[model samples]
Target chain A: MTDSITISIDGVEIPAETHHTILEAADKAGIYIPRLCAYPGLKPNGSCRVCTVLVNGRPQTACTTPVMKGMVIQNETPELKRLRSNLIEMLFVEGNHYCMFCEKSGNCELQGMAYRLGIKTPHFPYLEPKREIDATHPDVLIDHNRCIFCGRCIQASKTFDGKNVFQYIGRTRNKKVGVNADDGLGETDFAATDRAAQVCPVGAILKKRVGFKIPIGKRIYDRSPIGSEIEVQPKDAGSAQ
Target chain B: MANVATNGKRIVISPVTRVEGHGKVTILLDDDNKVTQARLHIVEFRGFERFVQGRPFWEIPVLVQRLCGICPVSHHLAAAKAMDRIVGGEKLTPTAEKIRRLMHYGQTLQSHALHFFHLVSPDLLFGFDADPEIRNVIGVARKFPELAVQGVMMRKYGQELIKATAGKKIHGTGAIPGGVNKNLSIEERDGFLKDLPQIVQWARSALKLAKEYTSEHLKELADFGTFESNHLCLVGPSGELDLYHGNLRAIDAGGKTIFDQVDYQNYIDYIAEEVKSWSYMKFPFIKSLGPENGWYRVGPLARINACTFIDTPEAEAARQEFKALTGGKPNAMTMAYHWARMIELLHAAEKIQTLLHDPDLQGTDLVVKGERRYETVGLVEAPRGTLFHHYEVNEHDQVTRCNLIVSTTNNNTPMNRAVEKVARDYLSGTTITEGLLNRVEVAIRAYDPCLSCATHAMGQMPLAVELRDRRGELLDRRAKGVDAR
Candidate 1:
């Protein structure tokens, strides 16, 4: 077992493991550092800068940066909050996020983050990129319009399902999640029950015939804001990771 | 060309005011100052059909409500009903159906209250010929503070009812494909019940105000853009006024049935829309009568004329008095729309009161599904008129085609007729007075036209008036509430 180390975050010292990142350590201490591209048990991609925090007076992604002894980090500063909100808004403008009708509206992490961060509207102009929806799959759908290129599905498919179904293709602004198989998702060896199908943080990868199964008030984030669960964890609660 | 008024000049009121959306009126005058031609032009175009293509079928209900802010609940429910068919969920559970009804009634109550008090009351209370600045909602507030408060409170109550049932005041996702997403909780029901009686009492007072105003100004209002046309709406199983769900019913000026008990799913078989080059909106007519004379009136007056009796007591009694005014014939007076609207407002209040008492609203059986279908049509009696939503979903659950015939579109031809009638009766000299502008607006307001949904736009645009000679030379131009050259 790795030895535990103490790190000061926002003026409070918290115990962290030798290999734990700032986000993992903060999360274990009941502090939620907002993230989009990083998930538990998955390698931190640091593609989305929502969790950017000050570490030793330098900005670093809390998800990707490992904790060190006597390290001082600032997570909830006003500058960091604005920075995170801007990153969230950038994600909104990069895709066609129609939250009003989106099946994943109340349950979506991206939307829940926006609600939690008090983003009434995105400051950036909508790109409104015309993207094709691959509905050729009989039991799965990929609406590229709502894709944020977070690569969670890509990682989940490769790591959890032992299948290389999704990948990041293209470069810069045109970058998107691409399928391994030719033609469409229907032609791919993908199942609706796959971990990749359920790992999308947005409405991009949705199972067919099962959208909006949960009611409004009963949805995951309706009663509580995003990150509330992590924030309400016991101070010494064990981390899922 | 020969019978021209003042060298064939045209008086154009671009972007009519105090209405939901943007609209314009062009009145052509001959050399003798006779109004030669009048047209109410819908200048904005909402390509909602093209926008909806390729979107998943399930998204249609919540997606279509983006069309209008004033009556989003109407569109939401109408589209959801159509999607329900696509999902084989048309036979909704009791809880689902009741919740939807509650939402619709709440919408009607709020919409009617907003229109009557905020939009229409200014003209009625202060007189149509009053100064343009003082003849508005603020003026009504300053002069008749109590009436304004009543309107605000009534609107707020109805909105709260919608929020509780629909989940939000704006772009609600309460109604879904096949069923509602939520049931009215006991707590929400109690909260609304506490305020129900007050809303009903206010509705009664509003109805009385409209009734007295129409009676006092009967002579003047009789000739105020009044025309004999067909009236159409939905009627319940026993021919009661049903705003939420009912078979289609149409009545002639004499209250004679043109058609009754026709399933709205086959609405295309009976009703067809005509596209005129002058307007973006379509003129829907009874196919049997043809576009020439098949044009009919809808909304409050039409609803009152089409239904045999209202279900609720106070509204039923009010409807009787309204019908008796025309000796049991369809009331053709345009201004009588106010009185008719108030009656419906009271009916919606009474319906809300009754629905709150039902235990089904709290039931957990909120959804049902059966055999799936491809193409479907959903119709609802929106606050303005009958709104039609038609869609065709493919096997992949994506919408292949969509067609929406909004209430304002249904009343397109009738609105033009009203404008022409008002212009022909009021326009005198080339000098465009504020009274003339107000008169044209008053006539159009009778229909409560929502130009936004007709030619959809977001932010409010001021009403503009352009006076031009027959030679297309600009004479004088003025935009109300906005400084524009």
Candidate 2:
């Protein structure tokens, strides 16, 4: 038997399961908590602090923190909105995300979050760090310029695909996602059909020869905002439909 | 910079203004203060061709648009056309081709309007000798309020058309490798239809103004920078004027056909680029004629001279009157670019109106693909002149090689020729006057060159004049929009 609990989010009390994280609970009740590093069915790493919210008067990542009975969470406050926006802006400046020409532009989660948060232009000065590109893979390519280090592929490959193909290589500012083999993604047993290939939230790790397959208006994010799938239709309502 | 040591004097114009990108002019004179050599130098360098390597071929149409803010649509379409060939989708569906054509006509209309009213009007209305402070768009507004407003509205209408067809005014994703991304909505079509008549009327008025200005100053304008040169442009299958898709055509000053109906994909066989150490922009000329006599003029003047006739009624009438000025020969008068540009403006307006009424725009079939190829070339007539985009893609769909011959680059030699002619005709003595400096600018302005597209750079600087003696010592320095000593 699963334990049931109730939580207060932005002054609205919603019933949730004990195992549900703050993001999962809020999503169940059709309340959108903006996030980037978190995805459906993937374990949350909380690497990106975009989903940071005040849980019981303390800032915590909503995607990693579990829901408790009668706990008060602040998600849509002005202060929290500003913090989330700042985090999103930092992610943008730290990477060379040329959204205009990127293949994943209309479908990219980072770009979608920017659109949802109304970030016409980032306030911070761009770092414009030089990055490397590994296109040796016959079926896949990685462009480090657009990588946000979300760790979704890292988790998805290991847990879902049952393969340990990706890992974090460097430390601190020099850190980047490294392949399991020495040569590049080509040396690894990473196929384009792997679950990891479908989990990238950005254009960093892409399957070759499949870019811009969808037109402008029919893209994933073009139909709706990033979190509208959760906000517009609740879990119960979506199941009933 | 120039070799002032060998010359008697050198006049350095650090930057040219009222143009799209950054450029400088250095006029070297003999001991008697006679102009001997003049070169237009492209100061800024953006290695766009090198940067484009290793990028995905499909992303090129949108990526190359970053080349120029003023004429991005030209790059977008040209790159898309090349990619279409790479994907073996060169035979675009009627709907896709028409939509792209609509976008192109909008670009020409808006770019021409902006250049004529905002950039060149002050020179034409106030005369070349007018005060520098009062000779600009602001002066035009203060003197001719109604005309200024018309210019603004005309430009705005063209922008709306671009937004409707291309998806946005900047960085549009409407055009793709195989075809365009969207069809014109009925609502968008009706919205443009509402303003079509007013836009056509403004285009006619602008044409009349340019024609009257040319006629009033015919004798003086003839001697300004007049010279015999070859003309180049793209002509339709039947020798009609077509800006979007056509075959290559070149005509000599005496109306002799140099090349007609040559396929642009084999442009290398007919045309070649020559590099000079003094300028970053390459000089493009006809291969058979050699670099000396092969240098030709492009843009509006070239189009008017190369095409047999325009399909539209009003622009054809205007073209007929324009041709009569040169007795049906190629018009070599440099200032006549303004008049030819207005005739194109009218033609672009007429194209937009006709395309709006075509039901093919609302058709659903947008893209098509076939067996793939690796290397391809695409060409289109931009607002300035013919633009070329060539790419070689690998099996992985990554671009292996890239090359671009922008319109302004094709006109590099001719621009230098015009600068030298103006320098010899108007410039005399050691002292530099504002009116005399403006005469040189007026000659370059006739071409409406976009140095940014030619040099692949972004920043533009002001025009400065520096007169130095044979010893290379700076004597007098005067700059437009800059402090003068």
Among the numbered candidates, top TM-score falls to 1
Clashing pairs in 1: B4-B30, B4-B31, B5-B29, B5-B30, B5-B31, B6-B30, B6-B31, B21-B452
Candidate 2 per-residue lDDT, tens place, B62-145, comes to: 899999888899999999999999888889998999999999999999999999999999999998978766888999999998
Tens-place lDDT per residue, model 1, B1-485, is 01112334433333467888766666666666566676777767768888888888878888889998889999999999998898899989999999999999999999999999999999999999888678899999999999999999999988887888788887888888889888988999999999888999999999999999999999999989888999889899888999988999998888999999999999999999998787777889999999998989889999998899998999999999998888999999889999999999999999998999999999999878889899999999999999999999888889999889888888887887887788778766665666677887898898888888976554555445555456556444444544222
lDDT of each residue in A81-186, candidate 2, tens digit only: 8898899999999989999889898889999999998889999999998887878788888999989999988998988899999999998778899999998888
**Deviation from truth (RMSD, Å), model 2:** 3.4
**After superposition, which runs of candidate 2 have C-alpha atoms over 4 Å from their true positions?**
A118-125, A136-140, A158-165, A180-194, A207-224, A235-241, B1-15, B468-475, B482-485
Q: Provide chain B TM-scores across all predictions.
A: 0.95, 0.95
Q: Model 2 chain B, TM?
A: 0.95
The interface root-mean-square deviations, each candidate in sequence, come to: 1.8, 2.5
Evaluate residue A162 in candidate 1 and report its C-alpha lDDT on the 0 to 100 scale: 91
Q: Give the 10-residue window scoring lowest on summed lDDT in candidate 1 chain B.
A: B1-10
Give me candidate 1's TM-score against the actual structure. Answer: 0.95
Worst ten in a row by lDDT for model 2 chain A: A232-241
